[model samples]
Target: MAGARVDPPVHGDPATLGGYELIGRLASGGMGRIYLARSAEGQLVAVKTLLAEGVVSDVERRRFAREVELAQRIDSAFTARVRDADPQAELPWMAIDYIAAPPLSELVRTAGVLPASAVQWLAAGTAEALVTLHGEGIIHRDLKPQNILLPLPGPRVIDFGISHANDLTRTSLTLGTIAFTSPEQARGEPSTEASDVYSLGATLFHLALGRPPYRADSDTLGLLAQVQRGQLDLDGLPKELTALIRPCLAVDPGRRPVPAEMLARFRQSLAGLPVSQGGRRWLPQRWTDLIGAYERHGRDLARGAGIGAGATAEGITVDQRTGMVPPPEPTRVYTQERERAERERAERERAERERAERERAERERAEKERVERERALLAQERLREREWQQELERRKAENKDRERAEEKARERAARARARQHASGPSSASAGAASGTSRPSSRPDPARTPPPAPAPSKASSAVVWLVALAVAALLVLWLATWV
Candidate 1:
């Protein structure tokens, strides 16, 4: 049946599948197609259908069956529960509990990477799922953001089609989305628990940065190459999460922390955290009130001081032309002191602001320097990688040439031997007598050849010679100056 454009296709007319009523297609993938189905008992279940043509080979069919059976065995609150399966059937299919929730990809697309609280919740939920999967010795090889469903209670990990059970070498399934694949996976290694962790790190990186860690023009290979070499920019990420994700995305799988351990650490990092721990609290009302009060108080203070400067304490008006009654000594002293304090405070504030500005400038300068350094390092790494690839290509070409030359030499040697044998046989047939060989004196051993300097050695000698000549010239100039 043709599936709808909408993700997790809506329910439709009933079509029977192994006595169960097929309602509609939920999702379609390369491995199989999922359909919303209802059983005889009227319980809704998701049925996955494997195409006959798709599983033409026995190995492919067995692999499909194993996936279904394995998925059925695993059960977790954070994971979609597999209800039943018929692996041996002509058209293999598996049924799982129907979960009603939008995938994380859709949610994030609709409402940008969720608020910090939501992100924390997402992390916690996914961590729990990982813990369950790890305990069962199962690695969800394809742990992309889309596979994670955001339900009302929490996040639920779905689509275990590419999951490996216990023995990593048992399956050769090329699992995982390109953008989220770990370095090892890119290098053609099987996905391990650490691979899942790397994927989580990639997802989190996307959540924080609003983009993947690596940006590339081409497909998976380009992203894989970037992943193999790219460094995460922690400046754009929250300082707390940066440390956690760094090890998760480490190029070496052995370096990443276990799922449970990572979860525990993340929880510990977030436990009892104040709203202002990261930065300014999001208190719009309080901010508005403070601003309003400051403006009102400043205006009132200015007006009062202005009026008091000209008016007498006894309600009598003072004249400026004639020497009028001067303002009270106490008031004048207070005003002068207040003005002086105000000026001092303003100066202090200005100095503080200047210092902050200078510090910010220094930070910008340092940041620029760091970026340049990182860019240089990345460039150097790329250059080295390119050089290594080129060297390999050259070596391969040289080996091919050497092989051809050896084959030609061998053929020529064989022809020469045959010619010599034919000539000796013909001579024997002609009754030619053998001649006695005369012993010749061996030539004197050649004189020991001088060792040639290496390129590096030659360059060094040239440099040293130039330096010595320069020193001599300087010495001559010094003597002339003297």
Candidate 2:
């Protein structure tokens, strides 16, 4: 309805909130600024971020987080739906439906006062919104016209700035806009359902007559004092609305009627009107046409621009409009942690390399031992061959000695045979003379023991056998040493 309160982003403004790209400034207030953003899926949303300065205390943060919970609990068609929020974010923020509707303030300020039938429609919708909100144990402490949106479907109550549970007596905040504020809130008392009701009455009065019920001067203190006085000035208001809206502005909180009762009263007051004859075609003709044109234009714009149409984003783009987000945070970081992880990885690789080297060294040592054993075996074989050659040589030497001894024995035997033959046959005289001459020169051979030569041969053979045995024993000892 009213054009976006669009402004260029200033220096030091975050390019994105959580993840939604902040395209334009909607409106800035004491709490924070609202931004127009498009989600990844192309839906528009109004992102409200709390002022970093105002978010100093844990007490205030808890209170804000509590209000966020209240906003989430309300799921009514008459109010803007909360899409996302993170109370523990860097700066606390929330994303709500971006209803392309003008505020009641803008509508009234532009078009003066609403007709009685149009006001009934608005009242009915607002009362229904209040009923839904109140049913969920929530009170919209700030229900001024600026917070009320006039969309095609109906009025969508937005901005749960100071909403709280009715059961809680004290709020973290103690003040509100004085003109629309209830007497209790102006007196610094706790907000209640009755307080919200009174604000609704004041909002309705302003919608009906183009001004709030009470005002002395426009100063904050003066307006607050007038609200504390609990006075109403509905001089030229329609006769049907006096009874319904008057009780809502009661001085005592108990005297104010609940939203359901007021909704019934407004319904009864609008019963006789011709516009109320229709089920939902009850809006004035000018407003109906206006709403229709607004919707058609919205559709045409959507079709033309695609999903993310609102942003004329200049710088960095971060689309978080799908409403999905990563995990809030780990019990968690960047350079230092990454470096630590890198160090750990490097250490693991080094350990792996060391283990591989150890295995390689062990294999090499085992191979060396095998080579040494092979060398030892080759040396032992060579020693056995040398010992065999020495044994053969010693056997050949013993054979040669045996052969010479045999020849000497054979010669001695030949001489004995010749003597026996002489003794037995001829040359007895020669034999006797030789014998007498040789007696002094040599000892005479014993002819009876003729096997002495054989005996010597046997001794020679025994010596050869012993020499072979010794060679074999030497070979065995050498093998053992090797």
**How many pairs in model 1 have backbone atoms within 3 A of each other, for residues 3 or more apart or on separate chains, i.e. clashes?**
0
What TM-score does model 1 achieve against the real structure? 0.50
For each candidate in the order shown, give its overall lDDT on alpha carbons.
0.58, 0.66
Clashes of 2: 2
What TM-score do all the candidates reach, one by one? 0.50, 0.54
**Residue by residue across 283-341, what tens digits does model 2's lDDT show?**
55555555454445444333433123253222111111111111222211111354565
The runs of at least 3 residues in candidate 2 whose Cα sits more than 4 Å from the true structure, single-residue gaps closed, are 8-19, 53-64, 161-176, 215-220, 266-280, 285-482
lDDT of 1 by residue, 392-469 (tens): 999999999999999999999789656654454454433434453432122111332323535787799999999999
Model 2 error, position 311 (Å): 12
